[model samples]
Target chain A: MMYSPAIIAEAVVNGLMTGAVYALIALGLTLVYGVLHIINFAHGALLTAAMFAVWAVYVAFGLDPYLAILPLTPLFFGLGYAVQRFVIGPASHGSDSNILLVTLGLSIAIENALLAGFRSDTRTLNTDYGFQVVELGPLLLSKPRLIGFGAAVLVTVLLWLLLSRTDTGKAIRAVAKEKLGASLVGIDVAHVYAVTFGLGCACLAVAACLLMPTFYVNPRIGQAFVLVAFTIVVLGGMGSIPGALVGGLFIGVVESLCGLFLGDSLGQIGIFLIFILVLLVRPTGLFGAKA
Target chain B: MLEVRSLRAGYGGTEVLRGLDLSVGAGEIVAVLGSNGVGKTTLNKVLSGVLRANEGEIRFDGKTLTGASSADIVEAGLIHVPEGRKIFPNMSVRENLELGSYRRGRERRSANLERVFETFPRLRERSGQAAGTLSGGEQQMLAIGRGMMAEPRLLILDEPSLGLSPLLVEEMFTLIRRLNGEGLPILLVEQNVVQSLECASRAYILENGLFALSGTAEQVRNDPELKRAYLGM
Candidate 1:
């Protein structure tokens, strides 16, 4: 079974588009982990909720999913901030394990809540542009996916700028490295933690908007992406932003190529196989915390 | 000026600072000298508001800060340069300094930064480099220099001389003396009895969570028990 170069190019392009969204999903996860040192098991559930928000907005107001990004990002940011500041912060009480358990419980609670409200059926917005495709030489790329890749890149760049140039970003990095030192400088560790968590959820909202056009929404839809996002977080290193981005793309390509050779269902194993190999070799992750 | 009355703090049934009373007046270099595990760190933690005092009143510039968070303490201009020189390892030297004025010294950042660079010219040379890459002496200098960026009303340096070479330790004291000469009150917390007494206007020898001896530098240095226990006289 020989594949032509055109097929390979198309596969690579497809992989990149998928990988871009994966990176966006992972950006939030990595940022939270970087600052809070929490695994954030609720991430997928949060994504599911955001997707539902997009679906509800579209169904109710006939608004475009792309337009929903504006309001939802801030809305989710507030929700995440409140959850971390009021709920997670007090409940965790300065314990790492407690935070992890809380996030896990949050994930389960959110899943069940969404299940009760929306049921188990998958829902998707059938936008006019959803079926459109871009003809790129020998490749016929899905328009929404192409936009997802470009928007994802734009968001990544913006996020990078925010973290590098803003006062809040500096405080976040400071707290991530040294909590007591950050507080000593009047950073208000709890505030920074909540802000980081908010930024993370905001990223997920943007991702949900982009995903809704071409993807389905369900209580379990996010579960499909969250595990890969976690693997990307670990593969890229636990807290490194660039690591998550690069790892997401790399994993996407691996999955695509493995599917090409090993079939789709079995190709999923490619991600885990690489994850194991990376763990065995680097241990800290690629671009992880700077060796 | 900063004042503490009978500060008592501990961790989980093991009391570290019990009934400790101390004060630092304006423009005074007050040294709290204690050996390892004698509650110097605990005192720093309590003052900085990282650790809560069990029963005490801390008045800084006439405002109670005993129950305040570390942010409030910092906002009150009681900057703490903690032990182990906890500089953000991955951030650049310049960033670490810039973050010093994050709450209080924002208006004076450029000027204070210029002054700090002038004071620590070596730090200026490596301002663009990662702080973790700096030598121990430089990191200690960075920690103190960071506190200076805050323009603190009272600067607390916890074990600033730890891990420095003997010559560098002397140099550190000279640096502290110069900083104090500029009329910034300092709370010099250390285990270095000889140099601390030399640099401080007054000194207190802390032992077993309480001050065993405290008075003017001359009085503490000439005390018989202090010389016998600490200096092996």
Candidate 2:
């Protein structure tokens, strides 16, 4: 196939837009892992559930996905808090394998529940701007993708401020670093875990809402994205927030360029190739240290 | 102000603190000194709620704290500065001190922070530096300063001078004495028998998870058997 500068430029832009969505999704996974030290295998499943919730709201009240953010963020936060307090809290002290098994089981359960509840049909949101594209010079950008990208960057900044500047955020960071030491300083470690998990879920709520206008959702859609999210999280360092953002953008660019050069089926292979290469070269990831 | 009776605790199946009984009066600095593996750290863990006591009664300021969560124990003003200077290494000195009052004393956080800085002028200068980068002696000071920020009624220091230089060890003991002089009760756990006895009003020499000797610092320091066993006198 013949390539042009305009084609490459458009691909780069497309890559960045999709990368932002991945970053937002991966941020939730990293935050939970940072404090709880659990991979939260069911994180993508939670995203799928949030998408369905937003979808239901849209179908019932005809509310815009952006407007759905107000209620959904808190709703998922509560859901996350409950899950951590009631489900994961008791088993947290167990061995790593046990926790992994629990999360894996949870992933399967959520996926099955979505399938049972909504069937296997794919669903997409019908927004007025869903198909609209904004022309900039010789390149065109999807309106929905641009909004999603903007929201992702905005949330990232807000999260960074919260973690570095707020008391609650400092407490979360403390718990993330040293659990027993955090208690020595009078931190409620279990409560911190719940809050961190809630925050992670809240990110999923935002990601789900932002993504509705751009992508189709189904029970299995989460699986497609989860591997990519995991790749980004590992590439960025397990719990590094900035690392997730960078990794997501990088992966998006790589996938876009690969799809252009090697065709669609080979795009995922390209991602995995990079994942394995990173794992081989730097097992701790780009930002991670040898733990 | 702090009391632990017949405390029995251990890791999994192996018992460490076997029926250990200890007490500290208000405004007194009592030291629990022991060699490694004798369970001094275990006792601190039990008191701080890091490990559950198999059988014991812990009373702090007349409140039953035997099985209270760490947050509750800390809120009750039984602050434990854990062994090996367990400061939040990635956080700045100020942030580490701020976390000291996460559960209690938050209302007076800024004032308490200033007070801590006053106590350790060196820490004040390095308030923005990461705790991990501080020297061993400074880390211990930071740990204690962080504990003080909680406005602790009773402070527990575990191995505060573990790896300090001889000169720094002297400085640490003097600092502990000054803090105790301010009418704050302290339970100093250490293996540095000589300095600990010198600084503590009363001392307990633990062996096999039980105190083999206990008395006033002068009395214990003079005890022939205690001196020979711990100090190789």
Where does candidate 1 chain B have its weakest 10-residue lDDT segment?
B66-75
Model 1, B35-123: lDDT tens digits are 98999999999999888899999999999998999888888899999999889888999999999989988999999999999999999
Which lDDT tens digits does candidate 2 get at residues B1-233?
A: 88888989999999988898889998999989888989988898889988899998999889999999898898888999999878888899999999888888999999999888888999999999999899999999999998998899999999998889999988999999999999999999998998899889999999998889999999999999987888898
TM-score of chain A of each: 0.97, 0.96
**Residue pairs whose backbone atoms clash in candidate 1:** none
Docking class of 2: medium
Q: Candidates' TM-scores?
A: 0.98, 0.97
CA lDDT, candidate 1, residue B8: 92
Interface RMSD (C-alpha) of each candidate?
0.7, 0.9
Question: Which residue pairs of candidate 2 clash?
Answer: none
True contacts kept of each: 0.78, 0.72
lDDT for each residue of candidate 2 in A127-170, tens digit (9 for 90 to 100): 98899999989999998898898998899899989999998999
Relative to the real complex, the DockQ score for model 2 comes to 0.79
Compared with the true structure, what per-residue lDDT tens digits does model 1 show for residues A129-218?
998999999899999999999998899889998888887788899999998889889899999999999989999999999999999988
